[model samples]
Each structure stands twice: as structure tokens, then as C-alpha cells.
Target: MKKIYYSLLLTLCVGVSGFSYALQDAKNIMESVKYRDQGVDRYSDVDLIQTMSDGFVRSRSLKMYEKEFGEERKGLLYFTEPSNTAGTGLLMYSYAEVDNKEDDQWLYLPALRKVKRIATNSKEGPFLGTDFSFADIERMRIADYVYTLKEEKENISIIEAKTENGLENPRTGYSQRIVHVDTDKNIIIKDEIFRQGRLIKVFEVVQLEKVNGFWTVVEAKMDNLVEGGSTRLIRKNTQYNQKLKDGLFNQRTLRKGLD
Candidate 1:
């Protein structure tokens, strides 16, 4: 009887330890994803001009309209908004700044010829008519998700995360996502999106390369399985901490620059 009791206690202790480790691993993976997903590495008060190559190609159908298959729209994409596009042009202006817990963004539209102020609450809108939701673009805060370490082996970590308020609407979107992370560089390799209890999309970071000792992505792709559409963005002419002028992000400055 004494031996049996000791065995049960040992098993229980091991289980508890395993659970705690899982939780910590999950949190770490989520933090890693959040860090790389946003342009956080770029210090505040610097402006960046990224030439974009964007393509709206669908294998099935996305919108309520009509589509058979094999349709795509290619254009230049540019933006400063965290969750939306402020403007798009051959020459675009973007100002990035981090204040407190949130990052602020501003875009100077060459067409409207005005500087647009993107509010924090408005980050949920669709970006530039893309199938990708605006919420999909923002940096995922560590506080928003509950993490669980699913597995770790071969120098790689897999974390399963369920975030509160993850689904912004009643569209039956994702409340959880599983992220595959590279332990060596703390970079996110892939993410599986879930809606309710089903998988709906897969987001992948591609063309991972280091520039000037900074880990950066040359291409990022998101595919919507339910909608049968995908968005691909390619980045070029990327530079960090260019020491942009303070007045560039302002409305008056936007107008003056164009003038």
C-alpha cells in the first residue's frame, strides 16, 4: 500500500511539471511571433520606403461576386498603417513610431495629396481591398493570447495559442492559431489559422534572409482556404533607421513635400 501511494504521487508531480513547462514554452513562442511579425526592430522616429510587389491571385473565389478560377490582380502596395493601407504609389511615404504599448503609423497619399491619420480603433478594416483582414496585419500582443507549448524537438518549437477577442467579428473567424518557430533565431516559420474548431487559413513567412545583421523577410504570403484566395507581398529597397524628418509624418509636411 505504501509503495502504490508513492508511485501515484510521483506521477502527479511529473504531470504538473510538464504542464508548467508547456505553458512557458507557449508564452515564449507567442512573444517571438509578435516580435518578428511587427516592424518592432526598426527603431522609433525613422521613416522607411519599401517598394512593394503585390499580387491578388485567387484559385477559387473570395468575394461575393463571381469567379470561376485563375484570376489575379497585380499592383504596387505601400502603407504605413499597421492594419490597413494608407496609400499606394510608385513613390510612397511611410512614417513609423512606437509610443508606449502601441505603434503609430501615418501615410502620405500622393493621389489624395493628403496625409491620412490612421486611428487605432480603425485597424480592423480590410487593407487595400485585399482578402486579408486588417486585424491580420497588427502585431499580436503577448497579453492577448494564452499559450501552450505543444512540442519542442530538433531545435524547433511549436506553440499553440488561443487568444481572447481573436475573432473580431461574427464571421466565424479564428480564435486560435498554431505557430511553428525556429528556436535558433526566434523567428516564426509558419502559422495555422483556425475558426471555431476548423482550420481556415495558413500564413507563411518566406524568403527569410538577414540584411545588415537584422533578420528580415523579403516576402510574406497568406492564403485563405475558405475563400480560395491568396495575397503575396514582396518587399524591396528596405532600409532601417533612416532618421526621417519629424515634419514628414505631419499633414502640412505631406502637402509641402508634394508641392
Candidate 2:
């Protein structure tokens, strides 16, 4: 009778521990989404125009200077033109939280006068030349993805954020990502990419100094362990909640500037 009682107690304890862990995982995932959503919402508010503008300026100015073979480098060699870049440009979009959609466009080939619409399916591809993918631009609601609490220890909740079609690959198909959420900041501080349940890539982000009172991503790096190559992206300007002009996002505006 004593042995039976002890066995039951142990089983009960295990079940309770599992239940607690599941609940905590749910909470951690929820918190991660909440924090990201709040930050994005705040970023869209018009009240942060000044900060946004500052970030824009700094981001545009971020560049690496390199001397040419014959010393021809002089001005604006490292910084991209934004309009002519292959995968990057000034993002002009309107966020629709109520509808869970984003109306966004990109301006490329300024010399030819072209503006292209951003498709929902292509959100997972890299943004411009940076390591950031288009999905990184818009914010998603917390309830959109299914959450699994993978681990919990040392006051840190380990969550895996998985959504059906979470990552869209234009050329291939969809990809799955397991993100490690930082409970303290409610941010997805790290991620491991898997394709068909096989490890493929690892992504990391480092928080830098605040720009315009908003927590900004200072350095981001993505490694394709299988490909033997990596990309590093760094952002200097990060401003939130600024008034944006309607025409500024237009293709014509991209060619004409803020005139």
C-alpha cells in the first residue's frame, strides 16, 4: 500500500509539472507576440514621426567605405540608392491590423520609373540585400500562430512559434522556424530554421542602443550552414510612430523625392 501511494504521487507530480510547463509555454508565446505587436503598433503611430525620420536618415546613411582599385571611390559608394537596389527600397506601406493585412509596395529601377507591389506570399524572402526578410517588415497579430512550449528553465520560457505557411519561399515552398523568445523583452531573440524537419539555417539578432526612444535591432546575422555563406545586416536608424506622407511611398514619389 505504501509503494502504491508513492507511485501515484510520483505520477501526479509528473502530470502537474507537464501541465505547468504547457501553461507557461502558452504564456511565453503570448507575451512574445504581445510585445512585438505593441512595438509595431507604436511604430505606426503618427506621434513618433520625429524619431522615425531620424531612424530613416541613419539607416539610409549606414554604409561601409571601401577604396577602389584606382582610388575612384569618392561619395555614396557604400550606401545603396534605395530606388535601384535589387531587393531593397524605401518601404511604403499601410498597416491594417483590423484586417490582418498590409498594403505595401517597393520602388526599384528609379531610372525606369517602376514601383512593384509586395505580395503576401513573398514575405519570407530577404529584404533588399539585407539579411532581413520581407516578413520582418510587417507585424503579425499574436493569435495568428500556434505555440508550443518546448522548454522552461531558469525563469526563461522556451517557446516554438509555428504557423502554417509561416515562412513563404517564392522559389521553393514554405519553411518552418522555431523561435526562441526572450520572456523579459517579449521579443524573438533567436531562431533556428528547419526545412522538412531538417536544420538549415540559424538567425540571430542583437539589440543596440535605442534610436528615438524605441528599442532597435542593431545587428542581425543569418547563417546558411549548408551553403557555407552568411549575411550580416546592421541597422543604425530606428524611429517609431511618425507621420508619413501619402506620396512618399508612391513610385513617382520615389523618383521625385519629397517634393
Q: Worst lDDT window (10 residues) for model 1?
A: 60-69
Deviation in angstroms for 225 in model 2? 2.9
lDDT tens per residue, model 1, 5-122: 9999999999999899889867866666544432222322112222223433322111111111111111112433442333332112221223224433344565677656556565
Return the top candidate by TM-score. 1
Colliding residue pairs in candidate 2? 43-241, 48-241, 49-242, 87-128, 88-128
Locate the minimum summed-lDDT window of 10 residues in model 2: 44-53
Deviating ranges (above 4 Å) for candidate 2: 1-103, 129-131, 141-144, 164-174, 211-213, 237-252
So what's the TM-score on candidate 1? 0.65
Off by over 4 Å in 1: 36-124, 164-173, 245-259
Local distance difference test, candidate 2: 0.49
lDDT of 1: 0.53
Candidate 2: residue 220 lDDT (0-100) = 63
- Give Cα-based local distance difference scores for all models: 0.53, 0.49
